[model samples]
Target: MTRSARRTRRTTRSLQVAGVSAAALLALSACSSSDDASSDSSSTPKSSSSPKLTGTVTVFAAASLKESFTSLGKEFEQAHPGTKVTFNFGGSDTLAASITGGAPADVFAAASPKTMAIVTDKKDAATTPATFVRNQLEIATLPGNPDKVSSLKDLTTSDLKVVLCDKTVPCGAAAQKALDASHLKLTPVSYEQDVKSALTKVELNEADAAVVYKTDVKAAGDKVEGVEFPESADAINDYPIALLKDAPNAEAATAFIALVQSPEGQKVLTAAGFLKPTA
Candidate 1:
């Protein structure tokens, strides 16, 4: 072969080798970059990208649970940054009616199992009702017991104006049970829709006495005096709580219910005169 032709062939071979090397380097660099990206993605926490508990958790609770549940609602809000707790406190029956009527609610805490059954029977409850606390009836009289009311029987006196919870309400039903157990009859001056209302009548001096839950009388502070009766043991109420089926904020409602049944919640409830649930 001629010298010029040989030189051209060597140069061409050298250029081909350089091109191959460059292509190999580019492939390695791209592979390294892909590996680095994969490692970074795996290192990130999965929970960080998950949706957080947010929005309002609406709870329908018996009037007697007003104080303790309100405190718990605040604690729940503090625990979850972007959450809110709202409550509908009233007669358990009334609350159940509202829930079954398509009212939007996330949770229900009824004063009695019977009242809770009103919702559960209609499949309004997403979960089985669990009794978290129990409440006993008490006679609430004016501060200092001006009427000298000491026992449940004292409220039965016709001369004294006594208020009672309506029969449909847990408080009134418990009171009636206690009365039946004692073989006695009480004719209240008025039948209030809830324990709070019955207690209020005595607090405002509109009535001489009222039969209400121990928790209600305790919540009334110095406005009323509580008298404990032996018959109350037979009529203690079981306060059941449940998650509603059509809950708009089921996630937060579940968390709130957990908080209510937690040890921290029991501390708040027992402090407010609510009896701890029996085994």
Candidate 2:
């Protein structure tokens, strides 16, 4: 072979070898880059984004839950930027009736299971009701207990002019249970439809005292004095909460219920003179 041809052949072989080496290097670099990307992806945590909550969440709650639930509602609104929490605070039975009667409510928080059953029995609750807190009866008297009402029996004094919640109300039912347990009878000046109304009697000086929840007396602050009795232990009412079946905003309603069952929500309730639920 001619020298020029031999040289050309040698040069072509060298270039081919270099081209293969370059292609191999490129493949190795690409593999390394892919491995690094996979390792980085495996080590990194995915960002958790919660669904945005919006619109109004209407809650029908017992009168006794007014203070604490109101606070929770505000916190819920703040945590969920575009959401609003509206409440219907009233007698548990009335609220239950409203729920069963097709009133648009996102949630229900009742003072007693019996009242909650009024809605649950009709399948109006989206979820099984869970007890969130419990409350016991207390004698609410004028500030400083002006009449010296020291015990449940003291409220029985003919001239004391006590007030009581109506028999249908949880507060009234619990008060009756306590009275029955103590084997003492109380003749109230009037029977109010709800606990707040019954407590109002004492705060406004319309009645000397009233049988109500300790939470209510605490909420009244200096307006009324609280008198605890041993019989009240046997008459504690369990407050239960549930998501309504026909809730306008079921997602937000469920979230609110979750918040109420959370530790932060319990702190608010406990501070309002509510007892932790046993079951």
Q: Highest TM-score among the candidates is held by which one?
A: 2
Residue pairs whose backbone atoms clash in candidate 2 = none
How far in Å is the alpha carbon of 16 misplaced in model 2? 11
Residue 107 of model 2 has an lDDT of 96
lDDT of each: 0.93, 0.94
Q: Residues 45-137, candidate 2, lDDT per residue (tens digit)?
A: 999998899999999999999999999999999999999999999999999999999999999999999999999999999899999999989
- For candidate 1, lDDT tens digit of each residue in 1-279? 999999999999999999999999999999999999999999987765656889999999999999999999999999899999999999999999999999999999999999999999999999999999999999998899888877878777889998889999999999999999998898888999998888888888899988898898889999999889999999999999999999999998999999999999999999999999999
Candidate 1 colliding pairs: none
Off-target runs (Cα >4 Å) in candidate 1 are: 1-50
- Against the true structure, whose lDDT is highest? 2
- Model 2 residue runs over 4 Å out of place are 1-24, 31-48
lDDT of 2 at 160: 90
User: How close is every model to the real structure, measured as TM-score?
Assistant: 0.84, 0.88
For model 1, state the Cα shift of residue 152 in Å: 1.5
